[model samples]
Target chain A: MGRVSLAGVSKTYGDPGQTVTALTNVSFELADGEFCAILGHSGCGKTTLLNMVAGFETPSAGIIRVEDQPVSGPGWERTMVFQDYALFPWATVRQNVAFGLEMKKLPADARAAIVDHHLDLVELTGFADRYPDQLSGGMRQRVAIARALAVSPRVLLMDEPFGALDDQTRRYMQEELVRIWRREPKTVMLVTHSIDEAILLADKIVVLSSRPGRIKQVLSVDLERPRDEDSPDYLALKRYLRGLIHAETAA
Target chain B: MSGAAAGTAVPVILPARRANWYRRLKPLVLLAGLVVLWQLVCLLWLPRLDRQIAILLPSPVQLASTAGKLIATGELPHHLADSLRREAVAFALALWAVPLGIAMGWWRGIHQQFYPVVEILRPIPPLAWIPLSILWFGLGDVQNEFIIFLGMVFPILLNTLEGVRQVDRNLIRAARSLGAGEAVLLRRVVLKAALPQIVTGLRVGLGFGWMALVAAELVGANSGLGFLINDARSLLRTDIVVVGMLAIGVAGLTIDFALRGLARWLLPWSQQQGGR
Candidate 1:
């Protein structure tokens, strides 16, 4: 019964003067424990669609629901890890990890246990006392992951969380994320422009079209855990996703 | 090994305890050299020994003796305490001005309502405000505080406004993405992000504030370094004036150093920002 659905969702900006459509009549279903990746070009509404699910933005039309509850606004039941690795710069890693727990108004002793658990989950246990800037790009993203997971939300929303990292770090993080995603299995909706990442991480890949984005296709990967990138099958799928994304970009 | 090469290399492989002091010492030694040359010139230019002291300079020995005696008597402490008291009042006034100014700046409506009045009053110099403040607040701490506040507020207000505006858009997006409600976003994310800038504004504000307080004290205060300098001028005691001037410079340097240390301690992330 734990599934999120969007029916005829649309988003438009501006008043009566000049209206701009970002998303139009978009509909999709994400079942429990599904890892779905939305991929698109820069100006495309991949992020906007992800924001809708994160409750940062509202669909101007149609219904969006998680477990049959209408999407109203951002709530703790859904957690998001942003691209910028937004750990509070003033806060130590442990404090940043503890913030959502604090906001949920959980008592301190219980909150500490939850925070420590996720910190360990992300393998950031020893670096808990360090500030965000002290950690490398990949480490900070792990801290953000720890923070999001600490709240134990219904679903996890990620918006290109590795976008700022170097290519090597980005690849390494994708592997770590797949491992974490399997163990900590929450339904995750990730927005990315990287075809390689989408192929690597997603159980179901939802391809988004260019600006004024609409879903073009959803390809489900029937592959196993830690799918070999060097495998011909994985390479073939990567090439196919890359071609579609490239065709969209060229257009 | 050549004596000079070995001596220089041995001492300078790493910089001195004060890194820039080695560079500054050359100029300082040059300055001392010039003073010696001046004294020698005065010996040639003037008639006698006593006349030479009057025409060119109080010899270093004389100034040192005066400094020694000033320290020995309770006079230095009395004047120092008075100066510190005025400085404390000024800094406090500056602190009050900053938060009020920042609050005004953050809310656009308050900024619009008050900015014009502040701008109109701002151009009138603190020296000019000296007379009016004395008249309105009477002849003591209040006048000094008012003068300092007037001097401090504008910089703090302008810088604070800039800080608020300069907050990274991505950080805000990140906060919102993480399901941060409005109050948490503003209080935790916005304010903390703006803090290094706010500390910078406070430093600049307090520097100007201290100068304003000294000017205000010159108007009616009977104690304080400003008064000490004025009294010395009236009594034709240049040595005391020298003491007062040196006191003010040293105290200002000390306070600024302390403020910088506080900034470093409080905002460790500032070090990373600077490195970038």
Candidate 2:
């Protein structure tokens, strides 16, 4: 029931004369509880695609639906975890997580309970009172994820959620993400430039071409849970994805 | 003696508490040095000058004695109260102007309508409006207050506008995606984000208000620190004038310090990041 379908979605910026095409005829469907990754180069319009789905930006031409209902604007049903971990700097971790619940006008006790639960889910229980600046980058992103999940959104949109972390932290966060997602399954769409990240986390990888982005390929990741990166199958898939992205970028 | 020699071999470590005490006293020490230097100037340079010039530049002791006299007569407090009352009125008025600025900053239509007028008037010093204020409100507290309002309002208005405008776009989007409507977004995200800048504007505006209050009093008001200085100048009481000037400086510093404390208390998160 949490299916997200984007059909012939296109987005253009600026006026017609100086127009920049960001995406072209992008079409895809995210099934209920499916973990999908949108892999692309820097200017591949992957973020634009994510923004459209999140209802932050409207597509110039397209129909986007979630659970057979069209998305007109941003709603709690489609929550986002931003790349920069846009946890409000002015707010404490608990307050940031509680924001959505507060907006929903939940009772004070109920809001607190949900915030506490999500903070626990993100393992930020003890640090809930701390401001975003006081935490490390990885911890801040975990707070951001906790904030997003607090709303109990049907679709969780993550745009390069681990892009800001160091390699070690990034890998660690990927494992944490999978563990969290497995615990509370939802329709997830993660956008990333890292092929290894896409292969490691996503059930299905949708590779996007550069500039006026279009889906170049959709590869199903049939790898087992807690997949070993050192295994031949994982290495083979990583090589294939790397080659695809490299070829598209080189072109 | 062998035990003493062994103890001397170890490195001496400064206690953290003593270091903190030194840090705290540094500013006071520097201030005392400044006073000493001023006294030296009065003794060495002023005494050598003509009597008239010497009278014009009173010694720090002379200034302090004059302040003591003013305080004894309760004249200083009376004049300060009058000036502070005018400042309070001006500040209250400036508070009303902040929302207008926020509206102008937030909405394109409102900004286009009001921002040009603000831009045009912003460059003109508040003192420049003194003549018009006198004509409009007559030589009274109203005239002084009008000038003070002019001085305080712009900084508050401009800073608030900038603060609202500069609210991170991503934060707004995040709020929207979190099911916040426009009203909730403005109240929770935009206003909270802009608070640090707004507090900055308030602190800056308060200093400007004090400046304008003095200027207004100098021109038209019957009482205030500025009037006290002006009256002292006419009476050739350079000491009283110096006292008034010192009062104004100290008062401004106190007010600024209080506002900084208020900002810290109000926005504790900003305090952690050392504010905007």
Candidate No. with top lDDT: 2
Q: Over all chains combined, what TM-score does candidate 1 have?
A: 0.86
Candidate 2: C-alpha lDDT:
0.91
lDDT score for residue B223 of model 1: 77
- Candidate 1, residues A115-205, lDDT tens digits: the string is 8889888898999999898899999999999888888888899989999999999989998998888788899999998887888899899
lDDT tens string, model 2, B141-243? Answer: 9999999999999999999999999998889999999999988888888888988888889988999999999999998989999999999899999899989
TM-score for all models, in order of appearance: 0.86, 0.94
Docking class of 2: medium
Q: Ten consecutive residues with minimal summed lDDT in candidate 1 chain A?
A: A71-80
Model 2, stretches more than 4 Å misplaced? B1-23, B27-30, B40-45, B272-276
Task: State each model's C-alpha RMSD to the native.
Answer: 5.2, 4.3
Off by over 4 Å in 1: B1-60, B101-106, B169-187, B272-276
CAPRI quality of model 1: acceptable
